[model samples]
Structure formats: structure tokens, C-alpha cells
Target chain A: EPEVTQTPSHQVTQMGQEVILRCVPISNHLYFYWYRQILGQKVEFLVSFYNNEISEKSEIFDDQFSVERPDGSNFTLKIRSTKLEDSAMYFCASSDLGYGYTFGSGTRLTVV
Target chain B: SQKIEQNSEALNIQEGKTATLTCNYTNYSPAYLQWYRQDPGRGPVFLLLIRENEKEKRKERLKVTFDTTLKQSLFHITASQPADSATYLCALVTAGANSKLTFGKGITLSVRP
Candidate 1:
């Protein structure tokens, strides 16, 4: 079965630095989403992208966050300034016609 | 405000037995509910979805029951094996095309062989 794939399974970055997490959703899927899980916390939604534009975002997806579908196959989340609280597991997901969504293994972001 | 709650602790069960997990919510009515499984350091994998109108749904050894009246959903795994051990999450989708979800802090299941 085709699955979503993400790059840089784990990343360590300095506080105040910019970082970008990349994902390649299923080829034929139309909708894409980003979610994050803080250690010992519930997974939280960050943003949803469709037609190369943001459909919805949560309060956690504030000024520092941005998502881009720079190419047909790549969906990237960029954080302008990383903070200690920004450390978490970031997941990418995709869906076809409102059916179940498939998620990538996730990228663990660590800020120090 | 809306809140979703799952048992914060892990559940231990013997192999070949049934494991039942509970998810409860407050202050919101969902159009649909969904369940997912996640292994350590992995993303959640979709397991099943049950709409508010439907009382129950089942797939293979997994079963889910939605009680909109009680604002709860029960997830059951029968004839479970050690491989069935993982954290299971329940998510709710509000009314709208955008359909953003609110998820409970998952319940971890540990099945001993």
C-alpha cells in the first residue's frame, strides 16, 4: 500500500533558528494535513492544505508557521523561529475523498 | 470548551482475551468519530470510523461503538495478540466541510502472551 513519507526522521536545531519539515503525501491524494504530538500529550492539529492553499489552522499554527506545496509531490512546514516548546513529533497525513487518512512515520523535532 | 478524555494509564490484558478501551468527550457533538492506532515513535494508523448516526462498526477483530447520547465511544479488540499492543486514539470531527478533529490522549494497551 502507498503511504505518506517524510524526510529527516529526526532533527535537532538551535533555538531561534529556522527549520523546515518536509513530507511527500500519497501521489493521488488531494488533501494534506500536519499534526504534532508533544511528549506525553495528545496529537494536535497544526494545519490543513488543499489546492496548494491552507484550508484551516489552529492557534498553535501562529505567525511562525507556514506550509507550502512547492512541488506536485512535496508538502513542507516551515517554522520561522524554533523555541524549546516547539520540540515535538510532527506528522504528515493525506486523504482521498474523505476516506481514512494515511499518516507518515513522523519527524521528531528537537529544539535546544 | 470541548474536551476529550481517554484513560491516561496503560491497560494490561492477557493474550486471547478482549481489550476494551473507552473515549469520552464533553461540550461538543461530533458528526463522526474515528479510531487510530499508534506504535511508539510512529504516526497514528487509521483503524475505523463511526458516524454519529451509526451505533456501531466493526472490521475483522476490531469493533467500535458510538454513543452520541452518552458522548462516548468504546473500542474493542477481541482475540488480541501481543501484536495488538499499542496506543489507540479516538478522534471527533465537528460539523463542516473542513472537518477539523479533536483527539483524546490515547490509551495504551499491553497484551501479554
Candidate 2:
């Protein structure tokens, strides 16, 4: 089965530093998503991307966050300034029909 | 204020038993409901999906039932094994089929052999 790939399985950064998480979604899938799960908390949707632009975003996704499908293949999420509360397991997902989604292993972002 | 809640935080059962998980939603109507499995330190993996109009759906030992009127969904795993231990999440599509998914806190199931 095809899989969505996320890089830097674990990352540690200073609180004020910038971080970029990368994802390579399934080739045939058109919709991509970014979600985060804080420790002991439920997974939360951050943003959804389709047609090379953001389709929707949650309140958690503020001006400090942005997503891009720069190469039509690599989907990336950038946090302008990382905060301590930003630490979480970030997941990347893709859907072909938008009903069932395939999620990546996730990248553990630890903001110190 | 859409809210989705799983039955509990954790459950443990003996091997070969059936594990039934419950998911309840409020303050919203969903087009479809989905269940996923997640191991420790991993992202959720899609397991099954049941539409609002469908009563029941099955795949092998796994079965899912959707009750739109009750605003709930049930997930079942029969003849469970130790490998079935994982956190299961329930999510719903708040709008059309193409909408984003809002997930519950998830329930952790432990099948002891």
C-alpha cells in the first residue's frame, strides 16, 4: 500500500525558532491535511489543502502557521515562531475520495 | 460547539473476546462517521467508515454501526487478539463528504493474551 511520508520523525527546537515540517502525500490523492496531537489530548485539525491552496483552517492555525504544496508533491507546514505550547505530534494525511484518509507516522515536534 | 466523545479512556479484555467501542457526537450532524486505529507514537490508521444512511458495515472481524437518529456509532472487533491493542479514534464529517474530519479523544483498548 502507498503511504504518506513525513520527515524528521523527531525534532527539538528552541521556543523562538522557526520550524518547517515536510510531507509527501500519496501520489494520486488530491486533498492533504495537517493535524496535531498534544500529549494526552485528542488529535486536532490544523489545516486542509486542495488545489494548491488552503481550503480551510482551524483557530489553532493562526498567523504563525502556514501550509504549502510547493512542488505539487511535497506538502509542508511552517511555524513562523515556535512556542512551548507548540510541542505536539504533527500528522500529515491525504485522501483520494475525502472519506477515508491515509495518515503518516507523524513528526514529534518538541519546542523547548 | 461540536463535541465527540468515546465511551471511556481505556478498556482491557481477554483474548478471543469481542471488543465493542462506543462513540457519541452532539451539536452537529455528520455526513459520515469513520473509525481509526493508532498505536503509541503513531498517527491514526483508517479502519472503517459508515455513512449516515447506512445501518451497519462490516469488514472481516470488524463491524461498525451508525445510528444517525441517536447521534452515535458503535465499533466492534470480534475474536480479538493481543495485536488488537491500540487506541481507536472516532471522527465525523461535519459537512459533505469532502469536508474535514473532527475527531474524538479516542479510546484505548488492550487485548490480553
Candidate 3:
């Protein structure tokens, strides 16, 4: 089965530093998404991308965060200034219409 | 505000028994509900999906029931084993099919040998 791939399985960064997380979504899937799961908390939707642009975003996705489909297969999320609260597991997912999403293993971001 | 609730924080069951997980939602009408499983330190893996028009759906030993009127969904795994032990999350989809989901905190299941 095809899989979504996320890079830097684990990352540790100092607070106030910039960080970029990358994901390569399934080739044929049209929709891509970024979600965050804070330790001991529910998974939260950060943003959804379709047609190479952001289709929707949640309040948690503020000015400090942005997403890009930088290429045919790469989708990336960038956090301009990481804060301690920004630490979480970031997941990337993709899906075809009316189908279940295929999620990547996720990248663990730890902001110190 | 939309809220999805999986009441039990954790559950323990013996092997070869059925494990049933409950999910309830409020302040929203979903077109379909989905269930996913997550192991420690991993992202959720899709398991099953039941639409509002459908009351019940099943796959192998797994079964799911959606009660639109009751605003709830139940997930069941029959003849479960230790490998089935994990955190299960229930999510609600409000818009078109395969859209962003609002997920519950999830319930952890521990199957004893």
C-alpha cells in the first residue's frame, strides 16, 4: 500500500527558532491535511490543502504557521517562531474523495 | 462549539472477548463518523467509517453502529487479542465526504493475555 512519508521523525528545537516539517503525500490523493496532537490531548486539525492552496484552517493555525505544497508531491508546514506550547506530534494525511485518510507516521516536534 | 466525546479514559478486557468503544458528539450534525486506532507514538490509522444514513457497518471481526438520532457511534472488535490493544479515536465529519474531522480525545484499550 502506498504511504504518506514524514521527515525528521523527531526534532528538538530551542524556543523562538524556526522549524519546517515536511511530508510527501500519496501521489493520487487530492486533499492534504496537517494535524497536531499535544501530549495527553486530542488530535487537532491545523490546516487542509487542496489545489495547491489552503482550503481551511483552524484557530490553532495562526500567523506563525503556514503550509505549502512546494512541489508535485511534497507538502510542508513551517512554524516561524516555535514556542514551548508548540511541542506536539504533527501528522500529515491525504485522501481521495469519500475515502478514509492515510496518515503518515508523524513528526514529533519538541520545542525547548 | 462542536464536541466529540469518548467517555472511558481506559478499558481492560481479557483476550478472546469483545471490546466495545463508545463515541458521542454534540452541537453538530455529521454526515459520517469514523474510527481510527493509534499505537503509542504513532499517528492514527483509519479503521472503519459509518454514514449517517447507515445504522450499522461491519468488517471481519470489527463492527460499527451509527445512531444519528442519538448522536452517537459505537465501535466493536470481536475475538480481540493483545495486538488489538491501542488507543481508539472517534471523529465526526460535518461537511462533504473525506473532509477535515473533529476528533475525540480517544479511549485506550488494554487487552490482557
Give TM per candidate: 0.97, 0.98, 0.98
Extract clashing residue pairs from model 1.
none
Q: The CA-based lDDT of model 3 is what?
A: 0.93
Model 1's CAPRI class is medium
Report the number of clashing residue pairs per model: 0, 0, 0
Off by over 4 Å in 2: B96-98
Highest DockQ model number: 2
Indicate whether candidate 1 or candidate 2 has the larger DockQ.
2
Sorted on DockQ, best first, the list reads 2, 1, 3
- Candidate 3 — which residues are off by over 4 angstroms? B96-98
For model 1, chain A alone compared with the true chain A gives a TM-score of 0.98
Q: Write the per-residue lDDT of candidate 1 for residues B1-113, one digit (tens) a residue.
A: 78999965699999999999999999878888899999999999999989889999999999999998899999999999999999999998887747666789999999999
Candidate 2, after superposition: displacement of residue A108 in Å?
Answer: 0.4
Residue A94 in candidate 3, Cα distance off native in Å: 0.5
Best by lDDT: 2
Between prediction 1 and prediction 3, the one with superior DockQ is 1
lDDT of 3 by residue, A10-108 (tens): 999999999999999999999999999999999999999999888889999999999998778899999999999999999999988577889999999
